[model samples]
Target: MYMPWPLPDENWFADTSRQPEPDHEDLRLEALVAQRLSIDWTTRRQQITVAVQNRVVILAGVVSNANARQVAADLAYDVPGVFDICNTLRLSGPRRSHR
Candidate 1:
């Protein structure tokens, strides 16, 4: 059996606009979320992890308190691509005084 050579679109070679691919949107959104999270100095950004899928943001990790968790959620919301948020942050319990 013989296979014919594949035909290429005429404009494909001429177009050099360097448009972003579809999959790149996720990375772009993730970067945006990370940037927003970093902007807040109070929250422990290092302890949290952000997951973005289909425009929904899922925040997971341990925070010092409920307010910190909420702050993480709010940071996620500030990103333009985030459509919904699922906050899974856990509180680390009350801080005990060290002797």
Candidate 2:
């Protein structure tokens, strides 16, 4: 039966069907996440792992010192549209002693 306002047709059971697609918000979020992951910090390359979700970026990895950690956080902040950041970076390497 055709399902139309003040109109009905026997072809209501037509084989043609509309497929649902991802919402614009979902697409936007996905694009932003991709951009976040693709970013590479020049100061610390091997000591970082970044994950982005819903505009929130999560960083989990190892660093050499407090300076390195600062670098990581700053990198996350540099990415546009990043509203939240969860830093879970562990410090590594020996601390430089000041004489």
Candidate 3:
């Protein structure tokens, strides 16, 4: 067969892996998640942190209650391109109160 251009070697595609690279997509995801959490009334006042890597969303920081924690996770999950959710939210203060 006649070729106008030289064909590349196999090594040309060797570096193409499925590993996630730090790019604008990750930044966009992070911003979207943060925006969702900030706008939602449940997580509006909570100190929740959102991080995205390889389309996976990581929710961290402390919340006032379990509902807030779940809300954060849910909001992150709702974002597009979110492959998975890592919820590491902790409840602030003691679990139970005594008089």
Candidate 4:
């Protein structure tokens, strides 16, 4: 009698194995966002994190003020291939008092 080889586990061919790599457009978008944030004078570099997914960018972290938050959002929006922006940056700095 001849014996057949054992079959591999079903999970071995799961979605992870066929995962797609990041395309050029996605990389460019991430770079663009980084550059914009780096060069902008209004942004607080230490308190921001940038994430790019499916052409949509998510901005998360703490900022000095609302303007900084808006600046981040606008910078991300200007990048090509950016489908949408989700600005989740929180403001934690002391408010400026107007005399």
Question: What are the Cα lDDT values of the candidates?
Answer: 0.78, 0.63, 0.87, 0.84
- Per-residue CA lDDT of model 1 for 1-99, tens digit only, reads 998665674454566787545456777887788777777875745478877777888788888878888888988897786789989988887778999
- Candidate 3, 18-56: lDDT as tens digits: 666677998999999999999999999998888888888
- Which parts of model 2 are misplaced by more than 4 Å? 1-42, 94-99
Give the poorly placed runs of model 1, Cα more than 4 Å off. Answer: 1-22, 94-99
Off by over 4 Å in 4: 1-20, 44-46, 94-99
By lDDT, the candidates rank as 3, 4, 1, 2
Off by over 4 Å in 3: 1-21, 95-99
lDDT of 1: 0.78
Native-to-model Cα distance after best TM-score fit, residue 7 in candidate 2, in Å: 44
- Index of the highest-lDDT prediction: 3
TM-score, cand. 3: 0.72
Q: Write the per-residue lDDT of candidate 2 for residues 15-92, one digit (tens) a residue.
A: 767756655654565455435444644443545766655567677878667776776677667666668778887888
TM-score-based ranking: 3, 4, 1, 2
lDDT digits (tens) for residues 12-42 of candidate 4: 4457766677777777888889888988999
The residue-level lDDT of candidate 4 at 97 comes to 93
Q: Is candidate 2 or candidate 3 better by TM-score?
A: 3
Clashes of 2: 0
The top-ranked prediction according to TM-score is 3
